[model samples]
Target chain A: MSDYKLDYLDQLESESIHIMREVAGQFERPALLFSGGKDSIVLVHLALKAFRPGKFPFPLVHIDTGHNFKEALEYRDNLAEEIGERLIVRNVEDTIKLKHLAEPKGKFASRNALQTYTLLDTIEEFKFDACIGGARRDEEKARAKERIFSVRDEFGQWNPKLQRPELWSIYNGKIDKGENVRVFPISNWTELDIWNYIKRENIKLPSIYFAHKREVIEHEGQFVAMSKFVLIEPTDKISVRKVRYRTVGDMTCTAAVESNATKIDDIINEIIATKTSERGETRIDDQVSEAAMEDRKKNGYF
Target chain B: MDILRFITAGSVDDGKSTLIGRLLYDSKSIMIDHLEAIERQTKNRDDGEIDLALLTDGLRAEREQGITIDVAYKYFSTPKRKFIIADAPGHIQYTRNMVTGASNSELIIILVDARHGVIEQTRRHSIIASLLNIPHVVVAVNKMDLVEYSEEVYNNILKDYDSLAGQLGLKNVTYIPISALNGDNIVDASQLLPWYKGDTLLNYLENVSLADDINLTNARFPVQYVIRPQTEQLHDYRGYAGKVISGIYKVGDAVTILPSGESSRISMIELGGKKVKEAFAPQSVVIHLRHDVDVSRGDVIVKDEDIPLIEQQIEVLLCWMDNKPLIAGNKYLLQINSSRVRCVVKTIDYKLNVNTLEKDLSPDKAGLNDIIRATIKTAQPIAYDSYQKLRVNGGAILIDETSNVTVGACMIQ
Candidate 1:
């Protein structure tokens, strides 16, 4: 390899850093949406690389669904504290109560959709013009069609058909009042890419990403962790299994894969050898419909 | 493995989506669940066979209408390279989408049906591939099975395309015969076309030389942010954070900050918070100067010897992207890299006809998807280079002031 050539990981890191700085240079009140997931964790790491020596220009905002894994929540808090960045957490529970919104009632009822309400509310509350996300195009088809700097309307609705033509690295973050842009700095990174980068940088992740013994209910060959958020059925068969989360989401909706991988290398190897996609293997919310993600994005769910 | 970003352009009838699907499937990048989802969708349709086109048609409306509405990016990697495919819609109405996709792609695969050799769609796509100055072009003669894999049909289309490429000044054009539906000459060489001896589409993509495409001589680093750590321990630390879009920067190199024309010497370079002796093109690094200068975001840091143009008036090939028509004296915000200035479209010299490459000098206004040669005068002098020479510094976007939408794409000349 030539000395001038950048490794793929370095290329990805540089691209992401450029984008994060674009957000910093473009928006007035921008926020980095930290979900405590691996992708978002990687986003924070890139932010450190992009704006270090100086503090992050924006605050880290999390719209907590109230059904998240305790480990992830703690990790989110610790990561923010260690980096000395401001973290603002808004709860879906508060939004649900204040807005008199109905809770989703079902087995494994998820607050994933409800989190969008809190997210939009938080955006309005902070008047954030740009919300930096870690959404990768490889995650879903709808996301694949989305531009790096995605513009959303006053209602935070994403119009996939009418997306502005984003050309080259020149991002247009110009938006009218009440409108905002959702910038995905890591839009090009794949799930495996994220794991590989995490390994390369030795970035810290929550313990739930590794193997642990947890009581889980098996549904259609998928393991749903036994948490209070899940509605226990009389006929449900629950057992303790050594498993690791492929993706971290609301505990009610995120499924775990049976694994004994404890280290980052082990996780990378598993991802490389796995036949299913990251969302397919773990996200219970996406399997609801063919256009589940698209529908959610249209209605202002990032 | 390194990365290869490319775009696939063709009309719906040309099997562009199927080619992308075949590439992903053959590369084993398609997860089992994604395959199953598409398989289920295919089973619901009229064709009993799995429809690969369903994979690229991402939106519900696109799936329902059986057309790609926007550019959907797809990722796949072989042992040799990681690939990012910008699957853009190819209809004339969606020309803007193709331009958007082509802007970032290093290579473009223009699919032409064997039965209808070198049609208008093929010509239009070739014109775009030239206008965007994409480094590589692959003329994929798809559906060779329809013509019985005849060498005559393939050669005829190849000959016609070679001339079209010549007309557009498209270099590094590679032609291949294939059947995307049957997966011939895509991942592996096809036995049917025994007379053909070129590399398969995947093999060529994996081995194409992209290192030379990056210009390493003209240094252009547009500062995106200034990192000022005013903390007690590091009170004097100040760094210009940005990506080196082109060329190289070494410690102690004399640099010039533009628009302001301030001069300084690089004291230190930091890559990912670590001090580095030198940083090359496309690396995001924090550059610290030996002496303090009036440098901030939108300032271009360059080697003092090779400075770019700092001009207020410039000619550009403008692609109107918004639904609103573009007219003379239209004021918009023109942004090139980190530098943005209010600008007015002085005049539309001529419209470049996409289909025939004709220059319509009498065009009154440019509507959506129209490409025209226009002159723009910026409120402030912005540093740039000719798009043909330095794409990183030359390409810009015009934002509509009132709507705050990206209304036009400009390739500075």
Candidate 2:
């Protein structure tokens, strides 16, 4: 009798697949916002499980910040090519140049804010009615309040106060023209759940997730990887450390944790033993303010 | 391990957030950095005790006002089960939030401050739990330490709530006395309340019987998308992709597609892109029919032996969510499962007074957070079971076409 009962991971997978299918059924011009992160990698896997045997209903869209890690960019291109799906790449660098956007000047000058411009422009370019993202509610506080089918206004601004009451499994994807919905299929999953599901499904991720020796500079206590995107000052303490990324964001803002967890099991064990939240340890952009994510979300950033 | 999704119902002062915080903290789900952040916020307080309530206040407005205005999802896990807590604000004005949270939950924990037991909010929360047809109910009598863990007080509250539960037809009710502030009877059994012989809250939650909650007798599968490869290799393949909302599906079983009444045999079932003989409830799978039927999205595939009710007019106990008042004869979109159709509010019958369990027989209009019984006429027939029978198929939502907002949640009667 217990055989009929699904494993928790299986349940999560089913729920996510259901959501992905809902997006496919509801919207006309939809796109999956792939970031080449483990979460997005899982999204692609779920999308395959959702609409495969048939070609994907929508294309894989990536708003490349240009400051992205080389390995992630290569992995993104390969995954799309291997899956035989359409890939749409919009550059934040081009958006910055075309829109005459002033780049933020700092030691770790993140193009995170500028990425929204490219994303909105791409949404306008393709007129994507629904954009599926890999955002999990467990990632941050503001994210916890977001609906599964989050509606964004004409400018892609997220009004947290005006969110629709998402009831049951019934999602209201009905929106007017110029208004888009951001569908997060993995909203219920947590960071640990993501890792566990990845391990269970045996999904492939970029090599940065595994432990590797890399040159990093210590800022506060977090190890920021030495990339051309960041400004390396003389006062910075540089060292070669065995580090891995807990989360994959732009190289300028995402920090690495010192670890020897090369295997998935070891990584899971380390996550269980760690005391810091995923954002607290890796996302330098979130450290600017307590409401940083909230502000970013309000400003049309995914 | 399985997952338990539950809702905690209480007001700002009910220590609802504190209880959730205690659950996460004791279960080792709260990380050190999150705790440190809370500590930083708790620094200026004269009491010196960390306000666990601060943990769930996510939005800036919520943090500044010190009130939860929206439903916030919090996760924690013990070795036994993973729990998703939908921490909803319990004020009367936030009934929409609670209804939204309760829609997906199998269990609801109605918090009762020991000092004030069986209050209006308690009854209101219970009414919602009953209306939503939540499978399990845990009446957590919190603030036991403040009440001196008195057996008489707990008994009195239980007596009062029992009659209310009876009136509301709430089944599977369990009671526990605890103090969220002192962490009594939350994760560990309370040393203070020795008179209570029932299992602690966490113990009961970890072992609750959720197997029966899934309706296996009646199979329901609503197609969300149609898969057609249209390639040289599998050019003839056509599949109906959907989640089995309930029951089981097997190869060679007779099936009927609703609204079209097209009958076909299940020739094949695919689970996770692999061929499978059978699939059960809550599983996402693609079903291939032996015959090519005219099937598309918004179609329900069901067994011939267990046909659901198909009707255009439905009586619904609706929770008006939007600020705009719901007037009789106004048009909206009624969506049941994957199927949606134009619906009109034929009549706003009566508003249910959540606090008193009394119905206002002549309510003119339904406003925000107001629960009312109404007759809705849809443009097309909807196949569904009663809300009390199968929650998966019985629940629906009313979408406002002009604003494109989900304005009402309808529990189809």
Candidate 3:
């Protein structure tokens, strides 16, 4: 309803809002996954717009890897406090110690994969029937095959061979006890689209996303932030340079690119000529194998 | 940028995946890191030349098994337009997956191997594109290099596919001959084919006119959920929230709630919390009515004059998806738009041979990937338009209630 039909971004926003409202209406207990990333930040804005004046029917779930950047954690806390919603954070650190899981060793090791255990544990503890995520098909090959209302089994596993046929906008959220749906409201959005939207909507993100001088070291052909979680090897080269992260995650794996994109518009422009993919260049974990993402998704490692 | 959604379907070894990969590559959409990853993967699998086919097959099983088992969505953009590509499996057993991809596409790309010319998969995909009411069709004569880029081979494919396209009622058919592997006439015009004068696949996709594809004559909106925020500032608010599937709706229009046959004026038109004067097709809106007429979810609203048929029994063309055979007298949960009803299959008129377009009139059952015509009886009357007339309002899916699996896709005939 407007003077003219919605352009691409508005249409995408409207569609995303419709999806969030659907998830809120259909699922008995749902939570929005907050990673302090740009996509999840937009998701929070959309969910608020979908149901405002009244508190959201669900809480915000953040699976804390505990290896996060300080700025990202600060932003997550501030956004949750400003919105006045419940933020339930379960840590991978706790899960690793309690479950007696071995931490990934060496310089390139990331707590990213270990997050799945804590995430699944949180879902089971709260019996959350649906967990909303900011995953987009454009992010990876395996994500492209995901349905909006993706179903996970009792063991928190995804069966890609038996995915249900989703027709039009009708999402069937029907699942039995012990099973939950991992809903993605922005499944169709591309990285460029997300950046363009963040610029247009003036959506805020963590300071790490914009360029600034940071202490970093080279790892697997990319510049990664120097952190306590990452054991700096004797052979590694340390440097202080102006850089920004395309994707923010655990500092051990998420790499930073040399950039002076101090603002959202600058970031959007930088993406236009970006030669490397975010998950490919930054997410060293997904680059473990060609089917690394597929294996992770199948093993409930979203 | 304008959005274009298209589907690519063809059997294995027909270069369907290779064509999609070519589009992504030549458009400069594939990033360097992704290319390196694929390069490493190709070495591991000894795929020879950095196999582009591996890029589109998403699942680990699909990669290990070397086949596409389900539909996967891909996104890319040129400076001119944005594209959403639905890559569907082409095996005969995965017709339901093809249908799922075609259900939302405005155009369909059916790749035909140049050596094979017009084959069974070519005909089946063409029929599916036509049945799904996809406006545009592209018959890409792929692997032209294997055929030595022969003009005669391309022309013969055009001639063979012309009759099939005519038979299937595919009005907007375009033929392009190209080698997806060597990157000919996909994103770049081919120097290999000097005799051909046609837009590259990427150029055509960006330039295609799809504004007129929407069904604007029949206004239909099925309420998915009711938005009622009972709060202090805005104490009274009752809005029927749904997407406008077709046509246009405006404030103060004489809209009627279907099944109940109650009439009311549209008091306001709300899109994403703001009141607007009018709303058009495909935009999600929360509409307010002048009177409270006992409206609820599953009630479709339309212009009072443009009423669709309200009936209990519907004849549908169904593509069975589940392993269990679809036989007459089996019950299912029938869902169309936002409406759901308990329904039973009344009778199977005939089973379809998708490859031959033949009908078996005396078929007792239809199993996985079988397309058949059957009559379905709903527990209550439902309002719908014919599939050919209005796709969004007409098409539905049959879900197995107990298992919560979507077993069949139905197009009301």
Candidate 4:
């Protein structure tokens, strides 16, 4: 007989898988949000476990911000192809061209906030009732209050006060027409949990997550990678440094940390010793205020 | 690493939030920005020190009112274990929030004010925790400094709590005397309690064994969905995708599909794209059957040798969560595992008095946030074990058919 004890990781995995199945069984049409980030990659891997020996019941969807890392985009496409799954990519540039979004001033301004418009538009376009993302509670204070099955109104706004009560493993995914549920299977998994899972499962991720030499400029106490969309000031000096991204987002907003944790095990160890949070180091938007993520989430930014 | 999820419950002034804040702060879990934000908000307060309560009181309305109105989850990890602290409200009106927070917790920390030992609210919280089957209870006697760290006051509270614990049938009870404001015996043991030789709060949380919390005797697997990948690459693959609710399931174990009376053997257990020898409760995996049967979602897979009672009527302990009272003869959806069946309340056996631990048999209607024992009749025969036997299969939620909101949670008796 196989000994089956409830390890912390196993328990977390079970809960996440239960959530994923709930998403598939409850929603009319759901899509897995693939961002080529470590969290999203882990979500895809869990989805695969959710319906094993069978193709994923839901399609994989990616909201491209146009300023994505080329390596990340390449990795995303290759992963989708390798898994033989349908990949749907919606671009914010198209949304901007279509006059759905206003262009911001300065080249370094982020399309991170503007992606919400395109995301809602894609949900409307595809009539997806549920969009499963890899949002964790430990990421921010506001996110800490989020339900596993977060319900969004017709306008795609999240009212934390009015969320449905999720008890036990039972998730209420019922929603009115035009209203959708934003399902977060890994809502309970912390950054350390994700790193530990990735290390244990040997889940493949984009190369950007590992330490590599890249051209970067220090901006507002962050090492902003040198990209075509980034506007470098005359006083800013470009330097080459070995850095790894704790998070993957739009190149204009995502920052890198100086680290030598090239391997997954080393990265896990680094995360254990690192005092700064994944978002604390990489997400420039959250550095603004305590309620920044909360405000964005209210505005339908996943 | 061990994972401990505990709920902190007490009356409004019992320093529940302060205790949680102290734990988070002393554990070094609070970041610089979070600390700064708390500092800026509490600048005008009496003490120049940051009011740690402000960290968990997330809502603007709650912050302005200086009270916790909802459940706020706080996470912190020591070198020993990771902890998920559910900071539940203490107000009598928000009993639903307390129930929600304590539902999934393995431990309940009932905070008692040493100056006011074992108040009505403490009894209320302890009763609810016991009702929810929280295996462990930690009675944290707060504000020892106010009592001059008097051993007499601490012992008085402990004696009262022990009596209450005996009444509630709580076996594993630990008493720790500390002051949340002074930061004593929380993360670190205080010198004031040198005579006290019990484990510190963090130490107790780190070493608590939660492996037995999940029932592993009766195997219950509710099929969430049937996976039939009709593609040519893997044409003949038919797997039942769902989480193992209880017990260990091996590849060659003889299994029975409930409601269908079909028998089969597990051909394989696949988890995360890898074939495993066996699967158990809470692990989401796909199980391959030796025989192709007409199985779908809501159907349960159990051990062929040991089958559960398949019945249309069940008596359950229900906790009403909706604002509307639970009226008999009203149709509601009772969802267990993947099975959703229309059920009606046959009778309200008794309403539980949370504070006094008394059963009011005269109440015909279960009000909002009331824990009541009721008998329910379902439209279809559902497979289930007693709550004491299997929490996953025995536990269910009542959904209001009209609003589609989960109005209550039911545990089969």
Q: Record all residue pairs in model 4 with backbone atoms less than 3 Å apart, i.e. clashing.
A: none
**Mind sharing the TM-score for model 2?**
0.99
lDDT of 1 at A85: 98
Candidate 3: RMSD to truth: 2.2
Q: Which structure is stronger by DockQ: 3 or 4?
A: 3
lDDT of 3 by residue, B1-413 (tens): 67888999886598887888888888889988778777877886654787887667677787678777789999888887889999998888789899999998889999999999888888888878887888899989999999888999999999999999888878889988889889999988989999899998888998988777776779998886677768777777887877788889999999889888899999998876678998887787888899978888789999988999999999999989899999899999998877889999999999989998999999999999899999999998999998888888889999898899999988898
- For candidate 3, give the lDDT of residue B270: 80
TM-score of chain A of each: 0.99, 0.99, 0.98, 0.97
Report the lDDT tens digits of candidate 1 across residue range A79-108.
999999999999999999999999999998
lDDT of each: 0.92, 0.93, 0.87, 0.85
User: In candidate 1, which residue ranges exceed 4 Å CA deviation?
Assistant: B44-47
Over 4 Å off in model 2, which ranges? Answer: none
What level of docking quality does candidate 1 show?
high
Candidate maximizing lDDT: 2
Q: Which of 1 and 4 is ahead in lDDT? A: 1
- Scored against the true structure, residue B129 in model 2 reaches a CA lDDT of 96
Worst 10 residues of 3 chain B by lDDT: B46-55
Candidate 3 stretches greater than 4 Å from native: A1-5, B42-49
Q: What value does DockQ give for candidate 4? A: 0.59
lDDT of 4 at B401: 78
Using DockQ as the measure, what is the rank order of every candidate, best first? 2, 1, 3, 4
> In model 2, how large is the Cα lDDT of residue B386?
95
lDDT of 2 by residue, B1-413 (tens): 99999999997688998999888888888877788889999999999998887777688967688666688899988778999999898998899999999999999999999999999999999999999999999999999998889999999999999999999989999999999999999989988989999998999999999999888889999999999999999989999999999999999999999988889999999998999999999999999999978999999999999999999999999999999999999999999989999999999999999999898999999999999999999999999999999999999999999998999999999
Q: Per-candidate TM vs. native?
A: 0.99, 0.99, 0.95, 0.95
Better TM-score candidate (1, 4): 1
